[model samples]
Target: MRLEQWSRIMGKLAIDDEVLEEVAAAARSRGVSSESLAQELLLEGLRGHKSKESLRQLMEAIAAMTSRDVEQTDSVELLREDRDR
Candidate 1:
């Protein structure tokens, strides 16, 4: 189920005193509501993880790649010659 398919709804969450204090401090530092701070923090943390999954999927497609798909960027022969000098 995706968000766009839903009727927009506000959900409830319960935070402990310790967690709420951290949120409050973050909110003050960022000049935003604790709710906004929490949402931003959640998105920031989760977005990187979500992109890594997509990147892993893209990398998996390399199983079908031929030699032409590879672009050699290393200087193995140059390094070996330089080393023998």
Candidate 2:
């Protein structure tokens, strides 16, 4: 809604027709303009980019999780026990 944000999105961007149509349909179903829907989609993508963790960090997290003893236990119980520990 701000002038800076509006200026940033003024340039053209490429998208497939099927994806555009889907975005338009969702906008209509939600009683919003297609432009608004597109903006929402773009913002969601940008937020995801900004928040994504590095591959090394992800691998480290996975290694830490898998190193714990989870044999013969349901995932939920394993997670609870891990958290308790």
Candidate 3:
């Protein structure tokens, strides 16, 4: 799942002509081949997906913690008390 752990695995993707044109233009602007640009975009997208999954997991954890019967305190007051401690 990490870029450093990635190996050269040949795969084919069918991109729409319009999208390919956009990718080609982007690649030309960056002075790289379309294939490289596509790979970079795919990696970036995968990283973003991983980040989103992490955030979702964190939210679920926060939800579980808050679902307890403990009384909720004012966050600002709690921070102030902690800071003064």
Candidate 4:
């Protein structure tokens, strides 16, 4: 691990008291700091969002492929015609 990875940059984050309590409890349960728990949750959410975007791109590509006529027709006949030439 890099030295920077171990360093924490202080930043002010706003959360309701109930939410803060929940995160604190979760952190305690996981044996990690509240800040670390929050960071982990945030990263997980970001990764999920990225996965959604990738899925959307794949869906669009599939839709595009289905929208077009891509199948080759009369393959044997075309090959025979070519061979005759």
Largest lDDT belongs to which candidate?
A: 3
Model 2: per-residue Cα lDDT over 1-85, one tens digit each: 3334445677656667777778878999999977898898889998777334676788788788774676556889989999999
> C-alpha displacement of 30 in model 2, angstroms?
0.8
Q: After superposition, how far is residue 6 of candidate 1 from its true place, in Å?
A: 20
**TM-scores for every candidate against the unseen true structure:** 0.44, 0.50, 0.50, 0.50
Model 2: weakest 10-residue lDDT segment is: 1-10
lDDT of 3 by residue, 1-85 (tens): 2222223343445566788789889999999977788789989998767577889998999889775788889899999999999
Candidate 4 residue lDDT tens string, 31-77: 99877887899889987675778899989987787536666567899
Provide the global lDDT of candidate 4 against the true structure.
0.74
Q: Note the residue pairs that clash in candidate 1.
A: none
Deviation from native of the Cα of residue 18 in model 2, angstroms: 1.6
Q: Candidate 3, which segments miss by more than 4 Å at Cα? A: 1-10, 51-53, 57-85
Which pairs of residues collide in model 2? Answer: none
Candidate 4 regions off by >4 Å? 1-9, 51-53, 60-85
> How much lDDT does each candidate structure score?
0.69, 0.74, 0.75, 0.74
**Model 4 CA RMSD to the hidden true structure, in angstroms:** 14.3
Better of 1 and 4 by lDDT: 4
> Candidate 2: lDDT of 39?
90
